[model samples]
Target: MTVPATAAGRWASLWGLAIVPLLLLGAVLAYLVATGGGLKTLQGPPVEQLKVSRVTLPERGVIQVHLVNDGPQTVTVPQVMVDDAFWSFTAQPAGPIPRLGRATLTIPYPWVDGEAHKVALLTSLGTVFEAEIPVATLTPQPGRDLFVRFGLVGLYVGVVPVVLGMLWFPWMRRLSARAMNFILALTVGLLVYLAVGTYLDAQEFAAALPAFWQGTPAVLLIALLTLGVLLALGGKRQPEEAPLGLSYRIATGIGLHNLGEGLAIGAAFALGEAALGTFLILGFTLHNITEGLGIVAPVVRQKPRFIQFALLALIAGGPAILGTWLGGFAFNPVLATIFLAVGVGAIVQVVWEVGRLVARNTAALGAPLVGWSTLGGFTVGVALMYFTAFFVKF
Candidate 1:
């Protein structure tokens, strides 16, 4: 028997609907891939072991050193040697190296003279990686200082996507469910990736804590596991009809999670951990964009009022400000870990919900597109993580 025109039309419509979001996702992925998957080049190991390749002194009193890392593992150099005199150096963390990576160290010097200087990377093992480089004799030039501060502020605001999502969700809602689902899947992947990544960072921080505070990890792990089980129970009880509602809950949980992420970033930067701060920022920025998508996914089922959508976005994002402040100023590792674990637990609960949604939606949409979207989403998260690790000076 031949299918009716109405049925055929409906099927065609469904297919058309699915294509749009997939296309948008493809475009975003393409952009990410083109930009080296948004990865930053890793800053090489400290200058302690290696010699300076070159040195230039700015007229205004800034010193720049080009250095190489020939170490087995990435190392951080908190100080550098100049003319047999050691100067406080801020070097980002170097990374997993099968063999080699290079990093440049920049320092501010008010005095100008052609000085023969030695650079060194001091390791915890009490060994020094040392190199000698020459600083050019240069005069100082007057320059404005506020540019750095202003530039940072602009960068911070630009990375935030929630405002844009709130503004656009009304229009985005006209798209089909398949399209929305694809976006939602991508969002889910991003969150899972971030949650895992942040949790690992928290563990690292815990490990780095003073030996006297070391017992906190075991206690935190147990508490987090217990919380995860309880949150999973709540997720299990969610009604199926309100799938979008479930998305809202997940987004809310993720928003809280992002707060912890902000705290990590702020604390790292405040503590003078430049390398760690850089990595955390890059990772969190990429993660935040997908998070913006998550906030919009549930409400996309029915085109929400712009104000309502924006409100949701704000609600989801509001915690970040508080988290950042707490992390930067409070500098409490234990508290940060607790929040990190809580966020991780909540996200784990949401991931289960997303998996169920994907399974149910695939039957109607066909496995091909859903599979592609799922893979694409996963790749996006993984690539972002790698890129964050690669570049962010960490």
Candidate 2:
């Protein structure tokens, strides 16, 4: 039986309308799962067991200790004690240590001269594992500002989308293509910088592994890269575009990306790496704004109702809250790299489409306007880099 063209079109429309809400609901569910069923107690590992390897007071002001987990299961070392003295500790919970996977714990030491101290790991299970080690306190030499600066870099990168949105409104829709292209180029620059500057540096820190695990850094990097590619490329079936401006597929993808970015920020902060946390927060914040624009840009093209535009923004932003909470617990450089790469790919696709639009609209705006707008976009990116550098310093 041949259905009328009108009937076919209506059916397609109805299916498209039904899909968005379903996808949104799924996104919420996935977020809940990632965050451990939304239960506070279940947020961390059931048990945290560790074998203390070494402790060093690299500087008189602050002491740093590195722990190696030789445990069977995942553990969270919530606090550490030295000689029965309370010291602030930042536990990096990398989950399940896989029978021998190592994790590091950094703690601050306030007392300059204390008799040889005993270190203890206070787990959620209320169990204490203690190891006594001698402390050598030396004059504090400032570590390079690179650690803090990289975080700021993330922050500035995050502000771009919000700035652009505020400056360029509905009337500026005509300029969207050129603006997006500029944003894409800027994002590429930042990502490349982060990939080399931040990711490589972290790898270097991990490279000082014991002889038994000297090759772990390289092996882990490769494994993470492969996993990232697979996850980004291998996913569910595609969906039809909706009249409201986005398809279920794209919205869900963006939502997931935002959520992940939020987690990166939250986890960084939770680990007591304040500089890194600030940077990630700023970077993701700006990144989310751009994503919001991406969601609404196409819908704006369709001249949708204001209510629809607002709904789209909420969908993109909603996932960020989930991401922030999840990030507080999990911090994996390889995983972060994968998410960064996926974002780069999506931004590239958007830039290509925008370029086509710009080419088509050249006649509408003279060459000078296009040139100026592009330059303006690039400047915004540069400014972000500078701001990040300034704020994230040791």
Candidate 3:
């Protein structure tokens, strides 16, 4: 049960940096709330000016745009026009404009090329806002669309760590059996934390939903169904290398979680919340580092080929990039919940699989001891998750 020197120091430093500041921040926030200073800020967003921007979509004729309410008070967009021609907005701002939030409105115009378009926004506050929206010529770039759109947000935050971990597989495979077991145990700890955290996150979303279906049961069912899908995919009762199978399962779960993170980033930006988008990127980046270890740990004894390792990395990491794309332009709450469910199921299985692996490897007398030994790693994972999670809701 002795703690590894490296692991102990790492966790100690992380906890010190994470917990102390979080405590101080909590106290400060509490004091602010008590004094109603923070509450006043939440009353409304600063409404000073109105801003407009044209959104780029695949179709050139479609005029997609949005407005940001920069001032403190609320402004409603009743109607809009393009080039003196009445253009209907698909999704108009239904409610009052929040302090700094944006309202996306799509106006599908027969946009003429090489022509300037003027958009006149009619608001309820007796203000006529006129802005020129320039339509761009669409040049098709087939291969680089993803990188151009979502950029490296997903790769940096969710995938790069897995790539690096894959590179270190040689060293990982050289570790002693006991050390490998410890790593396996540590991976489980991380998954356990993620499984619990993801379920809580689901609850938060569900609570926000309509009162009709208490989301708890739905959430549990979604997770179990996803687990069933995984089981169905692996038709056999059991695999020869259970730990490796478990490794893939864990990687799948981590990928789904990372995708959720990417979704948060994309949705934030799509909603024109730059500050939140940046915070999501930074928070997920920290979370992904340890996640790479979790993805790689169980496969240490398998001596997987380079292509196999690459496939694992892709399985564990590619969804992050895809999620960013979906979140930015096509965020669907239903899909987000589905991914969360899949992640939960994967993690649930991993906790069990890892427990079995740890138990079977060690002598009967030492299984409990191994479990105890991994507590430090598990605590570290939870602590780190919290530290990053403080910034982003997920």
- Which candidate should be chosen as best, given lDDT against the real structure? 3
TM-score of 1: 0.52
Cα lDDT for residue 160, model 2?
39
For model 1, what is the alpha-carbon lDDT of residue 96?
24
Better of 1 and 3 by lDDT: 3
- Go through the candidates in order and give the C-alpha RMSD of each one to the true structure: 21.7, 16.2, 17.7
Clashing pairs in 3: 45-99, 46-71, 46-72, 47-70, 47-71, 47-72, 48-70, 48-71
lDDT of 2 at 2: 57
Better of 1 and 3 by TM-score: 3
- Candidate 3 per-residue C-alpha lDDT over 1-394 given as tens digits, one digit per residue, 9 for 90 to 100: 3669889999999989989988999999889868777467556443335666334434667766666665556677777888887677766556767666678777777776555678788776557777764434332223476446585777777778678756666787788877777676667677877888778766655553333334667788989987787667656756686756776778888887777777778766654556777887877776667777777777777777777777778888888888888777676555677678768987787677677767776664365554555665556656766675676663
lDDT of 3: 0.70
Candidate 2 regions off by >4 Å? Answer: 1-168, 171-261, 273-300, 306-308, 330-337, 363-394
**How many residue pairs clash in model 3?**
8
Candidate lDDT values, in order: 0.58, 0.49, 0.70
Question: Model 2: what TM-score?
Answer: 0.41
Q: Sorted by TM-score, highest first, which candidate order results?
A: 3, 1, 2
Please identify model 3 stretches exceeding 4 Å from their true place. Answer: 1-147, 207-216, 228-238, 364-371, 388-394
